[model samples]
Target: MVFVQYTVLGIFFLMELCALAAFSYWGFHLNRGWFIKILLGIGAPLLVAIFWGTFIAPKASIPVSIPVRIILQLIIFALAIAALYFSSKSMLAVVFLVVVVVEMIIMYSMGW
Candidate 1:
């Protein structure tokens, strides 16, 4: 049970990484100038990372209730799914959504 718990946590961390990658992928694929592309590709994930570290990380600087944290997490993951879908990766988006849903369910059930 402990192993499963830690594994789920690890998967959650990977999901966060995937979200950043999704943002970068979307930004780079935008039909815009190189400057804009570079700015967004790097900046989007940076902003997300800052936000996560500030409010959503395990040892967040500004902690909230579990419900609020979960809501924020869902919002971020939703944005990542949208990014993947808009970037012509609908299948990947769906798969990501499924994994996110399962992870959230397990986390909530396990009180993680």
Candidate 2:
């Protein structure tokens, strides 16, 4: 059981990475010029990373109430999923959402 709990935590981390990748992929494939693509490809993930580090990470510099934290996290995750979908990777977006929902359920139900 302990192993499974830790594995779920690991999945959360991987999902975070996937979100960033999805955002970058969307930005890179935007139907714009190369300069805009480069800016967005780097900027989108960088902005998300900043937000995560500031308010969502385990040791975030600014802590919020649990409900607020969950809301913020969900918004960020949702935006990433949207990016994937808009990039025409609908299958990946659906799979990512399923994994996120499963991970959230396990983490919450198991009191992680």
The TM-scores, one per candidate, come to: 0.98, 0.96
Q: What lDDT tens digits, residue by residue, belong to model 2 across residues 3-106?
A: 99889889999989999998899999999999999999999999999999999888999988777877887898899999999999999999999988888888
Model 2 misplaced regions, further than 4 Å: none
**Model 2: lDDT of residue 58:** 88
lDDT of 2: 0.91
lDDT of each: 0.97, 0.91
RMSD (CA, angstroms), candidate 2: 0.9
**What ranges in model 1 sit over 4 Å off?**
none
For 1-112, candidate 1 gives per-residue lDDT tens digits of 9999999999999999999999999999999999999999999999999999999998999998999999999999999999999999999999999999999999899888
